[model samples]
Target: MEMVYANRMTMQTIKSSTQDQNPPTSPGDQHSDSGVVKDTMAKRSTLSETVNQLQTNYSSLKAERDELLTNYSSLKAERDELLTNYSSLKAERDELLRQLGSKVEICEDLFALQIFISMFHNFWIGLTDSNEEGTWKWVNGTTLTT
Candidate 1:
């Protein structure tokens, strides 16, 4: 008797589980279920598209950043080169100025020499008397003894 009772209880449980699995469905319920599935799929596809777009934008930005870095490096190299050239030119200019100063000093000395020569020439001319060879007289009216 216990075995029979247990079998009957088992059979009743199986029947209830089957009924729960296949709950009575209406035609309208089937349409609503399909609609929910379609909406969920649409949302998933939209989210996937957004993610793809973001990934593409990220790649493009990364490439641009790399390009900018390369350009910056090139410009830095050029700037260093320019600085080196500027230093060299500055040294050359300083040397040239030193040479020019020396030349100016030489020119001033030459001008002084020319002025002295002119003064000496004028003094010799004034000290000479054209009267006789032995009558050489100074401009102050002093006669030469020799």
Candidate 2:
């Protein structure tokens, strides 16, 4: 009889241990789990939207960067063309200056060098003699008196 009672006590202790390991969930625990699931879902949705917005912003910035690079390339080409033109103009101006050393000026014989130099605009005198030969005029609409 004592052995049978000991066996019954052991079985009850084993059942209690099993119940402790796998506890039954109450209504409050179920509600809490549902709330956690809802919270996790909300967080996931927010994160997805944030990622999409970031991707859109990245695309916009990339487009802007591409446009700026294109503009830079165009400006660089224009600058190169301008530099080439400047070099050509400088060479022509120097050649004209050398030729002027041999050519007699209309007013240089009568006026002082300073007086003739004062009439020059930026030290450049453009004669409009190409259109009509023997009829010369300054670019600023001053007719040659000689």
The model with the greatest TM-score is 2
lDDT of candidate 1?
A: 0.73
- Tens-place lDDT per residue, model 1, 1-146, is 35544588899987877745544486645554777887899999999999999999999999999999999999999999999999999788778979865221122355776776765543233357677776889556778555
Instruction: Please provide, for model 2 over 46-144, each residue's C-alpha lDDT reduced to its tens digit, 9 standing for 90 to 100.
Output: 999999999999999999999999999999999999999999997888789788763335544546656878765354445788768988987667788
Model 2: lowest-lDDT 10 consecutive positions: 101-110
Error of 2 at 15 (Å): 12
Q: Show model 2 residue runs off by greater than 4 Å.
A: 1-31, 102-146
C-alpha lDDT of all candidate models, in order: 0.73, 0.77
Name every residue pair that clashes in candidate 1.
none
